[model samples]
Target: MSEIIRRDPRAEWIARNRLHPLHAALQSQNQTVWIGPNGIVRKNPHAIAAGFIGPAGIKRIDRSGAQQGTGTRRSASVEVQLPLHVVEQPAYYVAVVPDMVGGRLSSHDKDLLGLARRLAGSEGAVLAVVFGEHKESAFDSAGVDRLLLLDGEQYQGYAPEQRVLALRAVDNQFAPRHWLLPDSRTGGGELGRRLAASLGERPATRVWQAEGERCVGRAGAGQQDIQRPLARLILAAAECAEPVSETRHEARPVELAWQVARNLPRIEDLGPVAVDPAQIPMAEAEFILSGGNGVKDWELFHRAASALGATEGASRVAVDDGHMPRSRQVGATGTWVTARVYLAVGISGAIQHLQGIGACDKVVAVNLDPGCDMIKRADLSVIGDSSAILQALIERVAAWRQEGRRDAA
Candidate 1:
């Protein structure tokens, strides 16, 4: 990680521009570290499929009374604009590749790119993307230029620590004024904070699409709403002193950026991006799925999970076992996912693991021993083979699908 040397205590003078230095500096230090690789994605503006893990729409089992298939279809489509990718100038942009779990140029990425193209001032942009573990990356496979790939060792799996190290390495080497990393989980937050600390400055979190929209955050256990007059991420600094026309060549880089950040949206504005949770004391989410030791090979584990629509998650065991992405892994050293419903499968329910996700609303356990401590902690327990339970669950979903078909006819 790039260490930001603090401002020399002996220095008698400092520049006003230093307030927003091109690079991140450690608090009280002169060392400035580059930070970012903002992972972006797009919102699918058009119609999409429902249910099952597949592209677009998933096919449903058409029933004629028996357990068979029909050539029928489901009517599901969302309205969307023609997808176009634009480019931003020197705005700090990094291209991150998603693993099998992710894909290139998702809808969110497209939208982010659109924003860069539409709003960025010239020469104020930089681009880098994280391409997940791939034998041949977009850099090698295509003639596409301007896409920087972070293929560090952590690229193969979701190794948060490793990724932090790699990001620091890039910042020190590239010297890009601003770094943009993924705004996903706590690991990303940890990296941002640690990176800012190394640089010696309180990092600037969650940038905005346009200027004037302030992003105010609240810290408490209640519900509130912060409405935006414009459709954009709040808390942005406008490089352009004056408002310019949309067609100005100086603005709009969405089309070119889409190739790298597929998950972006088609519009130039976005909702308020979140500040890294690591930097502040905030309540965690209200629901989580704690994947404990019960997760066998990635197949049986997630396969059984797919049978249920709950967000599939993992404990440190799953990550260490390489069964789940480090991003999904939960524990003390990892993220804390607090959900209303938490399912602990095969987890020993070790205090360390529980400490990470114990704030769950309802706990469910599927363990071999009905008397396991986790079972006691759970609101419901099924004393049987966890794998068998999953298989049965899958069978039930299949049956439900059949029933739905019959009801429709």
Candidate 2:
């Protein structure tokens, strides 16, 4: 059997620009800074290339460092021209690599698989690339048509470089058209971005909706739409709410040769530390008590949450203000919670914040603003001072506990 070979354009681009500072930064694993051919310094060339002009398409100064024009002013605005050489025909399969959450497949993983199935349509096959030790039978129940298991000791860690290497190896052989990954911090978000850069494909991140080849999302507060070609890569900030039905499918297992990466930067694992489970954000916590900007007293919020024996979570505002660590942030940009009961104290409820708790069974909002979006969506709304309400609730709970103890005595 003849092995199929495919050329990676991004690898070629990096090889050609090996002498450039940007390329050097990539190799050294330092912050990426780009000095344009015209000597204009940019924080990131990828952003510039995507938004303004393609880096390879940029005109460079001559060896003498002189402009080609004779004192002619350059145009203020430059039109971006897509690279013609990097275009490749779309493959027949849509590839999905699910991110493991808490040592198992999370809702994000299921949603990514669902999206892949939708995008695959009728003709294309859905290829699921699973890493680490997982029940192959569980994936067989997923809507995936084919499963590629890459399991070994090296694949055990959450090293982004190792995951990228594994994915790259699979891509080299399969040449899949669309690569779907979870847009998560510990997941394939960074890996997807790196893979896109390495493959010279346009990466669409934080995609909320996919209409055919176009992905819809928000840039800041403004609506942003990215049109992906048939052969492009997509990193969806998965927001699928529909429960995936148990589908029986014959999953064909593919065995791909795995090689341990050499000279790659290894992510240092700060071994587990002993801490109160309630202090940390739990992905599978049943009851979550989250604080927002409205809560005046951080100490009181923590005390109340601890008293109630609920996992603590914070809004983006609270997290940004340093009231809480980012690990406990519950929002679109933070941890997604599927808790049975979510108590939002003082949170005004931005759409991004609400998106994080979409899977909650019931939402209880305690905010001064009765018309806040959070209050509107909340199953129970308490319109009052958040701190006062929290203090009263804590006192009442304490009183009940004391009364119960006395009666028992």
Candidate 3:
């Protein structure tokens, strides 16, 4: 009797697609050992099913997927360059002021840019007005047609008055058809209101939809929808429109025609005050250390979070078990976080939890189960005991802080 081999091309394709929703699960099943881009070899001990016991009762192990002469492997390193959307001589401009939190564009900022692109249409340009020093390097992909940087000492810190002055100067030069800003607590909402007051233009607030001449926004505590003619300025809510993913823009730099007029400072610029990570709101947190059912030591977990300077988050099960407060829970039913780094310890990565951290830039998972959902979504995965990992992490962070102090001395 001969053996028959089977192949599933669809499964292989899904495994190679990093953007697919099932990518993590499919890859976890198909791969046991793989080389990362940094030349580090990662192995999944639980996925070592490449061979079976022979008739002689001798176990066989094959690194290659070739079982019974039928196996396939594929890579997902091919980069697809989007088509360029060029506006040579724009008839008008739709200026957008993004809330570049932590010197980089947030998901809110990108959503606002997507709305700006819609307003610009085919003939007009999307002018991005940036403030202070920025670390963003992908302006072209973010759909910026004209980049206007207002980087100055005056624009730094909590200077809404100074920012309004710069925006007024932009108004005099470009005279854009419309102004768009994010309607969040982050600097954008306040700045937009100030700009509207400074320019004496009635602005639409909490706007979610915009079309040819009319825009719809939330009114009366978000229970009612008000439709009105599009105002000169608009403060849009998050998810106003889909982000620009199909096309790239020029991101051409533009300079102001004249120097910005300065004014007497009313608010003194005091340096930032250090706040505890647990006190920070989940939506506004930049780094999070989350724990799940696999975490056995709650006291050590808290210590590790404090040492790492990360906001504490917990899984639904942890919260239900009274291990953490409901406010610190991270999932679809809980607060959605847009942290730059989300560290999950012993989490199985529920669908709701993954949805909550979908906007995070990086996800690092520490778990005993290599085939867990969290490991699939993690940018880096460490298969180990949660308590040991946390203890080592706390020690490492303490040593790093001590070295820094010594260097200063």
lDDT score of residue 251 within candidate 2: 55
| Residue 12 displacement (Å), model 3 | 15
lDDT of 1 by residue, 1-409 (tens): 7765454433313322222222123223322223323333422212112112122133333223332233332344532222223443344433222221133432223333433433333444434445454333322112112455554333444354455555555555445443433233533445555555665654433433333333322223324423333322212221212221122121121222222212222234344475432332223443344566775545665665555555666777767877767777676777765565677778766656667665554688888876556776688887877777777877898899899999999
- Winning candidate number (TM-score): 3
| Candidate 3: tens digits of C-alpha lDDT, residues 253-319 | 9999988877789999788889999889998899999999999999999999999999999999999
**Residue ranges of candidate 1 with Cα displaced over 4 Å:** 1-290
On lDDT, the leading prediction is 3
Decreasing lDDT order of the candidates: 3, 2, 1
The model with the greater TM-score, 2 or 3, is 3
TM-score of each: 0.32, 0.48, 0.80
Question: Would you give me the overall lDDT of model 3?
Answer: 0.87
**How high is the lDDT of residue 88 in model 2?**
26
lDDT of 1: 0.45
Q: lDDT scores for all predictions?
A: 0.45, 0.71, 0.87
